[model samples]
Target: MNDSGRAERRETVAEHKRTIILDAARAVFEAEGLQGASMRMIAKAAGYTPGAIYAYFPSKEHIYAAALGESLERLKAATEAAVATGTPAQRFVAAGLAFFDFYDTNPRDLDLGFYLFRGGIHPQGLSVDLNAELNTKLLATLEPLRVAVLDDGAGADRARVVTADVLAHASGLLLLAHTKRLALFGGDARAMMRTHLCERLARGNTPESG
Candidate 1:
């Protein structure tokens, strides 16, 4: 191969290895969480020696960051798909349910995204803002909700407030359902979301509603 071709081939191989390491890292992180999971465990899962994993990901924290970023992408996709169809109000309902359902099915992902164990600290060789990009990606998923909630001609600030409220409601529901606390109220995530949407709609349509 030409020199340039050889370089491209090497780059491709490196990317492939990184992808493999990240795939294994996600599985390990899912099973063991951030603090408990180890690079050796991830290497074993990836069918590589411990030293091999270190070549692609210098530390478990970097692997965790990559894994969480992947999860965040899926979460964003799910939320976007949910809000893609229906009327504004219908889209609102779909968006809320999507958030609940995504987390309900992938509780570990919820923990990863919400920083259950990772928290605000950074490990060696990882940026303090390692998860910052994922947070921005997650936040961008709120646009659909903003569009669904705001009345026509609504100001940006109002959209922000409404979107925040909707997100808070959805996040709260998922957290409760994940902890099995929602069961005490005789509802699953879907039921809670549906009821919350109904209440919001009622208040929105009422003559004296804010």
Candidate 2:
């Protein structure tokens, strides 16, 4: 093989190994969380030695961040798909619900995305850059809904505010529903979200000055 071909082949092999390590790291993070998980655990899960794992990922935090990035990509795809066919208002609502459903249906993924079982907001060992990148990925998943709101005639600032409100509402509802607290009020989270979105749309349709 030419040197260029050899180099491409080597790169492919490296990526494959990195993926194996990441897959193993994800399982370990799921089981033990960032605080409790160790490189040793990930290596064991991948059937590789600690040294071998290190050759691909510098630390468990890097692996955790990479895995979270993948989860966010899936989230982005789901929301993007939801907005592909509907009126602006309909697309806005669908994307919001899609985001909520992604988490509600995949409770483990919710846990992973929010670091619920892990370290929460202050995950240990993540660099500032890693944290910022992960946060960016998370917000990108919400961008479609924000764009839909903008298309519905809300100004940029208004669109941002409305998007934030939707995200907060969805996250709060999911937390309550998952913890069974919503049951206390005889509330269905999905139904409540539908009602909330309808109300927001109604308000957005009204004439506003200022």
* Top TM-score model: 2
Alpha-carbon runs more than 4 Å astray in model 2: 1-13, 118-122, 205-210
Best by lDDT: 2
Q: Ten-residue segment with the worst summed lDDT in candidate 1?
A: 117-126
lDDT of 1 by residue, 1-210 (tens): 999999999999999988888888877766776777888999999899998888888889888778777877887788899976688788878877777788889887777776654433333344658757656777777767777776433566766766677788888887787778988988767786788876776566333456
My TM-score estimates for the predictions, one after another, are 0.77, 0.88
The per-model lDDT (C-alpha) reads 0.75, 0.88
lDDT (C-alpha) at residue 83 in model 1: 72
- For residues 2-67, could you state the per-residue lDDT of candidate 2 as single tens digits? 999999999999999888988888788877879899999999998999999888889898888888
Q: Give the residue spans of candidate 1 off by over 4 A.
A: 1-16, 117-127, 151-153, 205-210
